[model samples]
Target: MMSTLAERIQKQDQRALAKAITMVDNDHPDKLSLLSEISGQEKKAHFIGLTGSPGAGKSSLVDRLITHIRNMDKTVAVIAVDPTSPFSGGALLGDRFRMHKHFADPGVFIRSMATRGSLGGLSRSTKDAIRVCDAFGFDYILIETVGVGQSELDIMKVADTTALVLTPNSGDVLQIFKAGIMEIADVFVINKADLPGVQKLKTQLKEFLHIADPKSWQPPIVETISTEHKGIEAFFEACEAHKKFLNETDAGKQKRKEQLTYEVYELMREELWKDVERFIGDDPSKEIALQKENDPYQLAKEWLSEWREKGGGS
Candidate 1:
């Protein structure tokens, strides 16, 4: 049954892909076992992350990049993470609407995820969705996240390469530097290059790169008017160069290993929290402490004791 579902995924069946992703996202005990059985057998895919300030034309750039990847006869999967409404717990789903050109294409799979208050700016489901894409046999998987402060930095953990997008005249180039985005970016893109101050922004970025002297490989800056599909080839070339750099650097291998370790610990933490909640039932002692203005650390210790007593630690 798993093999059949996996085959359906490779055939680009949208329903199968969606279901498979949900299975992974749920992270149920049985599902985890199944995932382990099939994990190493899945084909590897190129993972790319795109992020920028809101209104930086990230969606448009992704649309154009998808076209470029398709032109290479490669299948693409896009996970576009949008902000959720705090009250409603729902996303606008606007990113999928922007990439309408690929709506009917089986070769392109696009999914919109709600950030769901994940601290690092990505949805908890984002990694699982990417795994589904990888298992589905996509040649390239692109992750697009809402560009808010330090949230965009989370993309570096998930993507093999990250592109920090900025508009030519948004004055965001300096913000990127201040936010420490410069350190995480494998490539920088000045999107909306047709706008005024394109040259100025490009010059500023070049100077910043020179000062940073980014170790062995310097991040390349590419200009793109994504709506017009201009300079996309150059952007792809930069992505390829970054990939080559990763292959040649020992740092890249260590980085990936650390990322995997983090993911494992993250998963374990979530599971342990769930176990605690389940042990305490609806009226958890931790929740009661929050109402009384009690010490959270003490309450946490109490909960942990209760949890272990209930065999949660087992």
Candidate 2:
């Protein structure tokens, strides 16, 4: 069944792709099996991450980028992480309204995922969503994150190109830099270039980059008025250049390899946590102990010792 779904994805069936992604988002029992079956069908889709503070016009920028990408006759998929709806516990599905024109186009796919209390401002399944998009043969996949300040570094683990969006006079740049986002940015986009202080922001970025002096890829800062669709071309050119660099330098491959290694450990950690939870939940004694214990360190030691004694250890 998973293979059939993967074959449908390889054929670019949108319904099949959406179903698979739903599996990922819901943490379905067959999610991993489906992902494994579809792994090899992945094409060379450029994964671009857009992150910034709220009111920095990230949605507008993404809207414009979708138009630009479609103008170039390429297929693109957008996975926008949105704040969870309090009632439904699902993505609020707001950004789609701004980019509504593209919904009619067959080559464009936009999905909103609820952050669901993830401190990093992204859905836990976003990387898997990107992989699912890759299998569907899109030319590009754009991930627009919710604007959680420091934890936005989660994008670094998933994106091939991390574009940090900022507004000229909004002080978004300072907050981003202070949060160490500068270290992960493959490109810097100043979205409201029509506003004052564009040059000042540029100067600050230059000074910071100069101090950092990265030996590999030096991130380029592009100014744009996303509302007017200006500088989208330049922004894309910078992305294209970085994509080429990744292809030529083997950096992209290494990044994915490292991500895969980390995913392995992450998966193991998640499984272990589930097992421990089940172990504790099934036993009234453990629950009573948990309620009574004040020393977390000793309680953890006792839990581990008991778990190992009960055939949990190798």
Best by lDDT: 2
Q: Each prediction's TM-score against the native?
A: 0.89, 0.93
Cα lDDT tens digits for candidate 1, 30-109: 56654554467734788899988889998888888899999999889999887776666677665477688898888899
Structure candidate 2, residue pairs in collision: none
Q: Backbone clashes per model, in order?
A: 0, 0
Model 1's alpha-carbon lDDT is 0.80
Alpha carbon lDDT of each predicted model: 0.80, 0.84
The digit string of per-residue lDDT tens for model 2 on 65-171 reads 99899999999999998877446666666557877899889899998877774644565587688889988999999989877763368887878898988888777
